[model samples]
Target: MSIGASITVVAVGAILSFATHVHSSGFSVIAMGGVLMVVGIVALCLQIAALHRQRQMTAAEVQPPERTVVVRPPSEY
Candidate 1:
């Protein structure tokens, strides 16, 4: 997920975990929200790592190539 989406997920998770009070027999909303928040954090970390790698690759590709020239002594005057 993109950064924005990840942030949204975390926000929604936070709201669910803290803003509401719902009790169900099957599962806990707070726990679900915590899981979602963790997922969002993981996504965000992965995205950042991917972008960093891409930038490094781009920087490597953008560098100018080195050139070398050799001069030989003029043949017998």
Candidate 2:
């Protein structure tokens, strides 16, 4: 997902893990939240790294201009 989505997931996960208290016979809310948070953080990190790599690749792809030397005829003495 995008960065914003990842952040939202992390925020929601934090709220579920810390703010709410609900006990059920099924899966634990806190554990699920923790998992979501971890996945979101990993996605964010990978997205950032990919962006960084793209920038580096583009920079490397650019070619600098070539310089030329000019020759002039010798002036009569």
Candidate 3:
């Protein structure tokens, strides 16, 4: 979801850039660019959070058992 959102944000940015070049944006190119950049950063952060959560779950499921044995020298015994 986050990845898709980020992609969409970039696509929108590209469209805006091209549209501005073809037409004009005396109104607010800076505003559009700023919004797109903020949205993209948010999406990227979300994706990163999702990945970290997944890793945490995987680690929890794969933990090794604690029971184990060790051998000592007969002479010491």
Highest TM-score among the candidates is held by which one?
Answer: 1
lDDT at residue 56 of model 1 (Cα atoms): 100
Give one digit per residue, the lDDT tens place, for model 1 in 1-77: 89999999999999989998999999999999999899999999999999999999999999889988699988996
Q: Could you arrange the candidates by TM-score from highest to lowest? A: 1, 2, 3
Candidate 3 per-residue lDDT over residues 1-77, each given as its tens digit:
57878978877876675566543557666468667867787887889899999999999989988988799767853
Model 1 lDDT vs. the true structure?
A: 0.94
Q: What RMSD does each model have against the real structure?
A: 6.5, 5.2, 6.3
CA-lDDT, candidates in order: 0.94, 0.91, 0.77
TM-score for all models, in order of appearance: 0.84, 0.79, 0.56
Stretches of candidate 2 off by over 4 Å are: 65-77
How many backbone clashes can be found in candidate 2?
Answer: 0
Residue 26's lDDT in candidate 1: 95
Instruction: Candidate 1: list runs displaced more than 4 Å.
Output: 68-77
Candidate 2: clashing pairs of residues: none
> Which pairs clash in model 1?
none
